[model samples]
Target: MIHLTLIIVDFLTGLLAAGAWALASAGGAIAAVVGSGILGVSLFRRWRRRD
Candidate 1:
């Protein structure tokens, strides 16, 4: 009985860790896309102003 409980706990911990990793990866991707977009717009505006 104790062995079975430990197995279940380990499985749950692994599942939670995988979920957290996926969430973090998705958030990082979104932040990178937004950051690049902002950078591009800033550069475009600065270039136009110089002309």
Candidate 2:
């Protein structure tokens, strides 16, 4: 019984770690996309003003 409980706890801990890693990866991707978009818009506006 204790061994089973330990196995379940280990599985849950691994699952939680994987979930956290995926969430962090998604957040980082979103941040990169948004940052690039903002940079692009800023550059476009500056070029437009010059023209």
lDDT values for all models: 1.00, 1.00
Best by TM-score: 2
Instruction: Residues 1-51, candidate 1: write the lDDT tens digits.
Output: 999999999999999999999999999999999999999999999999999
| Residue 2 in model 1: lDDT | 100
Q: Predicted candidate 1: what Cα RMSD to the true structure?
A: 0.8
TM-score for each candidate, following the candidate numbering: 0.89, 0.98
TM-score of 2: 0.98
Measured by TM-score, how close is model 1 to the native structure?
A: 0.89
**Per-residue lDDT tens digits of candidate 2, residues 1-51?**
999999999999999999999999999999999999999999999999998
Give the CA lDDT, 0 to 100, for residue 25 in model 2: 100
